[model samples]
Target: MAYDEGLAHRLGEALGALPGITAKKMFGGIAFLWNGNMLVGVIGDDLIARVGPEAQADALAQPGARVFDFTGRPMKGWVVVDGAAVSEDSALDDWIGRCREFVEAMPPK
Candidate 1:
């Protein structure tokens, strides 16, 4: 299935101001990379966040969030937040910010 264009657009706007961020098409969706690291993306309207391993459990506990399972197995350090949960710009920003925090801390690739 194709990913949501609207969500992808929103993600672009959200991360537009950040330096070293780029958008790429992958996994049938649009991925936002920070400093060459995948930070967030939109998968079928859901928001995929790379919150890192240490914060995975906490991020998964949030409403409308779940494991980012693609190939019948869940990926560690990532979560997919339901699109509805991020309908508000503020909510979307929050998720993006969290993902950014984790990605920024990593050594640039």
Candidate 2:
């Protein structure tokens, strides 16, 4: 499977209530964008979070998170969070909160 439907649903529920958020198919899974800036996403059972350069170190320090390296070279401002780490609402919310700060600052595209 390209992605986890259950995880996608749960992510949907977590992000649905926010204004300006939109879900779209991307990178063989799904991504949630806020005003045209990607905030978070799912790939297989992992969660993809864009925490920006400033917060990249802190985000990587979180349990189950690693540098997003889909293209071989590591992406500094992004991370892939393990499904286990985000199984809880609190944990998922924390990711969203971190991503929100960066996404919100981007100009709408």
Candidate 3:
């Protein structure tokens, strides 16, 4: 299935100012990377965020969040935010910021 083009476009605009960021097609969607590490992406209209293991639980507690189980097995540090949760620009920005925080702290790949 194809991802939401509108969501992908919003993400692009939100991340446009960040340095060392790149967008690639993956998992049949668009993945935004930070210094080679995946920060966030869109899959079938959902917002996939790399919140890291430390913040996984907290992130999951938010409304419209669930384990990112794209591979059939859940990825421990990632969560998929419902498209409804990110309908607003501020909401999307918040998710992107959370992803950026975790990805930026990691050693460059």
* Better by lDDT, candidate 3 or 2: 3
Cα lDDT of candidate 3 equals: 0.92
lDDT top scorer: 3
Query: Model 3 TM-score?
Result: 0.97
Off by over 4 Å in 1: none
TM-score of each candidate?
0.96, 0.95, 0.97
Number of residue pairs clashing in candidate 3, backbone atoms closer than 3 angstroms, sequence gap of 3 or more or interchain: 0
Query: For candidate 2, lDDT tens digit of each residue in 1-109?
Result: 4898888898789889988889999989999888888889999999999999999999999999999998899987999999999999999999989999888889999
Model 1 Cα shift for residue 81 (angstroms): 0.8
Tell how far residue 63 is off in model 1, in angstroms.
0.9
RMSD of each: 0.8, 1.0, 0.7
Model 2 stretches astray by more than 4 angstroms? none
The TM-score between candidate 2 and the true structure equals 0.95
